[model samples]
Target: MAKFPKNFLWGGATSANQIEGTFLEQGKGWSTADIDKFIPKEQRKSGPADNLVKRADVEFAMHDKKGIYPKRNGIDFYHHYKEDIALLAEAGFKMFRISISWPRIFPNGDDKEPNEEGLRFYDKVFDECRKKKIEPLVTLSHFEMPLNLVLKQNGWLSRKTVDDFVHYADVVFNRYKNKVRYWITFNEINVLEMSGFTSGGILADNIANRKEARYQAAHHQFVASALAVKKCHEIIPNASIGAMIARFESYPKTCNPKDALANVRANQNNLFFSDVQIRGYYPSYIKRFFKDNDIHLKINDGDKKILREGTADFLAFSYYSSMVAISPDATEGEKLTSGNLKLSFQNPYLRSNDWGWQFDPIGLRIALNELYDRYQVPLFVVENGLGAKDKLSKDNRIHDDYRIDYLKQHIEQIGEAYQDGVEIMGYLIWGCIDLVSASSCEMSKRYGIVYVDLDDYGKGTLKRKKKDSYYWYKKVVESNGLIL
Candidate 1:
């Protein structure tokens, strides 16, 4: 197998909502993440909370007093950031990915002023990262939006929110411009296409057309992202700003030509997000998609110019599993599997994690090559890790060989991609330390090498301990993929 480069970035990633507790402390306002309550065991079978469906869901989440909101109480990273950074530094981390909570910076989305306490908090965190000699990769927004925006301006659905987000972007960009060199404008920005409130704080039922409103809101975000890119370049000339995507590569379930065609369509849909940001324009295929779906976007006077001028410097993405795509048939019964966003059939040959999510390390290599050959930009794997129900042994230690194996195979594939001439900037594990789950809002689905002493219902000491994978990863990083 090929070796990792000398300057390969090896680190961990955690979003503010996933790790930082004290959701309301220091004048921080409520985000969409904050309002996502935990479902009890009885209700979990029905599924996780379906928040942000309407105004009522927002009001209920905001007003519910006795609900078990686990996100509000994460691993208490707000208090343990220093210790966490030091541990990673001990493991020789070259980078650490974290998102600055927008609601923390600006209590309300449209506020004229930002919270100084929130600014001071991140200042301490970034300084700690820099002190450890670890470069910081900061995401402006990651699956979070100020709930106030939804109440006032319907989030990104309104042009006003676009300006508000840009203003928020300007404040943070200027504030941390010296500290942070690698910036992501929005985390999984394309998630807005399917999830409205989670990304954009949009309520579809309140709108006339759900699809139209979603795309229109996406247009607003595209413009906002472009404007942020332009501003970041102007403010921090040395910084590189990238656009992130939730890229789950699709596979044809069979050798049939029809299945291949269907797979092609699914893959194009996934690539559409990156194309707009990296290429600085939407592809013809997506325009055809918009026409076929009757999505007539309202292009403003200078929107096209902004998009053209604000292309991304690099492409960052999260790839966990490969999805199977097959032609729609009236007769064939499908064996479906867990997917990131879209529905798909299972790959019978691939192994699965405890969550039943199929794994394909080779698909990661293919994804890297496809992205490199198409965009020709530096790629950063910002999210790639295994989430399982990690159990603490009697000795109070975790021996997660399965996670290590999963990462080992995937890193080997990434190494192969590097040898294939793909310019990989770095690789960051999704959850370096255990925190709240974005899906179930539970600690049971643990993904961190550093385990947190916290339970699903906000119980436990909130302590941190390293697992076996921690030492293994340190060796892998120190060897620069030579040992793995």
Candidate 2:
């Protein structure tokens, strides 16, 4: 049996938009995430909002050029941050992973100077974390891209966006150079391949030449990420820069070689993005797939060098489920693909979240071993949790044994991987509090160890209540692992 280092980090993770509700406060400009709440839930193809967005209206006329109705306010995280952070601190989180909203810093996307007001917002948050002695792991871009840039430049489709993104990174790195350290250039670099909204902040349903656009967009992000890493090291010499990938551990349906082949293909599709970020070039399989699909990326010579020179210091992955890849067979009753996986309910044995993410703890060990073997870089479990529905008892306590079970089993696997010689930094649970869900925007699919009472219908108190998992997690962090 092996043990994690005594100083190994244990904590929770969240994005700015999902948790920081002061969407348009303190002179903050409207980000792409802010506009998303105004859009209808079903129209949110990538990640639909549950109940928060619908009841978010607070009656203020925007007086747009088209004279449209004003948008609603978010959960008001700006003011409630102190309360929330205290809860996380009480839960024994040694590290807190959060993204800094770029629009808040540079309102119109490209700016000669960052807003002092916006910079101060993060300073306060960081100061609070420092007070609690919690290490801050910041992601430069995590789903929240400036709206003006996305609409004007088609997000990463234009090369100029890459340069602009690097500028944003430079500004942030310089601002927090001495204080906050761990940096992730881009969150889930491959998400842009699947969902343009997530990848590029684009909401348009009509995407002209989507495959070409996705690859091109991804190409720009890869370059931007590399540039950010290079600039961050310059600003902060000892920065441990990493690239976060949304790793969905895939499995074959059966022992058949054909079924296993499908799983390999699925894994390749997911890994195509990481291969470039970590390996510094496109994989042969991806190149061939692009050729067959007529998807071409415009990469300059400088971009190649940037990628090669600034590879990720570590790999951060968000593991939610283990998807079974099934081969198309006339005899096999059914199969699961991206489109049909939600409706098919293919696997009955595995447990699923309210958002339909399969809960698999063994998948963590499998993913860690695979990643360690391939990249040989230290692995960080950036995001992993079970999104469930929790009810507060009359005694004002929320009992979330489900969340406890979910994280405990996952943490057990982390220990197992350590025994297997996989170098791991820490485990950051998805949401420390009930924040917006990435898949289904509904707050009902809550992931936080601390339960926020406010619901979709807007009836309950906006109080921070500790769930059973809170105490369980506190013990895990104090014990350094699940000794109990």
Candidate 3:
């Protein structure tokens, strides 16, 4: 039996945009996720690209009338919350992480009043969690920013979006103040550069200056996140607010000095966002980086003060896989893999998933130690899982031993990290139930212990069945990870 702290939170995570299928239902407006077009597996031979320009190029692909918009029908979880929550309770979930879709509350991003129907919907969901004694960890904004915000304000590029996001945060924080104690501001906030359209709603190709636009939008998010943290502390007493990042750990491909230095630089770039959120100020090297890139952020009056005053209570991040960094002059073939919206250089020693995401369980331990050494704050692993093609057996069960092996190895690594003195507050597996993939928008790339009877083309009965990994994970949570 593996051991974890008694208070450790064990649960699953799903964002509203990925699972809640009712995109246009009950006064909900269109989100960036809603406009995402699904590409089939056969056409995805080159794999999912993480560049902002490439993502923006596909923006108009949604206009095709015959295109399958899979996000619009995300396994119909919007209507199946009761059934889903019941299954989670049966699996012994101590916590359940979810995101409140911004467009759902405001209908449009800049609305003065939130939609009553959207607010009531979450009320019932949270009430159900409370009935089952499951703590709800809520993300204020995921990738589903209102499409209206992008069309009207050019997304977070305009500072007005900051105020709009703050308004939305204030409404949800107050509404679910009692129900949700854990709040994450901006999911994977650091991915703004690579995923501007999805992360900040900035259409990369349309912008005259892409670099400046990305950084400025990121600055607005930083300010907005800080403001929300301050507001949450004020409105919801004892609430713990965290800043989330996509933790892309990097290692030098070789022992050469140049390779090691490149790895350090790569890591610094990845750690920049959390540094500002946790430390409450920009790192000194950022000024030189910004100057070298000819990117100047517009910092308004009192923004620095707000940022300094409203630091996050903890750090929450998604660690999928680590990348290898090679020097500019290094002679080696670049083996690129896809995961977490970043193209990673493949590590020779690690095994990779079917999607080309390398599996390095030790990377989780290294990331935990690195983050703890840097921030000295409590950490929550909000997202980590293997997305695979699942097949159901004739017995009406998914014998997904591969998923079980993936999770078990990661859990063992997490246990080792805990023993190494990392203060891990929780672990929430990404996409607890099958949902639409954010990068590829494909439903076939499933990542859930509980299998949903759905297909890539939106065919099937939409029935929920527990995979073999479901019972395996239930025992893990029931024993507080000891059974792992």
TM-score for each prediction?
A: 0.97, 0.90, 0.97
Task: Go through the candidates in order and give each one's C-alpha lDDT.
Answer: 0.87, 0.76, 0.88
Prediction 2 TM-score vs. true = 0.90
Compare candidates 1 and 3 on lDDT and give the better one. 3
Best by lDDT: 3
A best-first ranking of the candidates according to their TM-score comes to 1, 3, 2
Task: List, residue by residue over 1-484, the lDDT tens digit for candidate 1.
Answer: 5877788899989999888879788999988898888885466653222324788888898889989888877888898999999999999999999999999999898889999999999999999999999999999999888888888888888999889999999999999999999999889877777777787788756576676777788888888999999999999999999999988788887899988988998888788888989998878888787878888878899898999999999999998899988888721787766655444577898988766678999999999999999999999999999989899899878999999999999999999999999999999998999988877788988889899988888889888889999999999999888888
Candidate 2 residue runs with Cα over 4 Å from true position? 38-74, 203-206, 329-345, 457-460
Clashing pairs in 2: 48-441, 50-441, 50-442
Error of 2 at 462 (Å): 2.1
Candidate order, lDDT descending: 3, 1, 2
Clash pairs, candidate 3, are: none
RMSD of each: 1.6, 4.4, 1.7
Superior candidate under lDDT, 1 versus 2? 1
Q: For candidate 3, what is the lDDT?
A: 0.88
Candidate 3, run of 10 with poorest lDDT = 48-57
- Give lDDT tens digits, candidate 2, residues 123-181: 99888998988889999888778766766776777899987898888888888988888
For candidate 2, the 10 contiguous residues with the lowest summed lDDT are 51-60
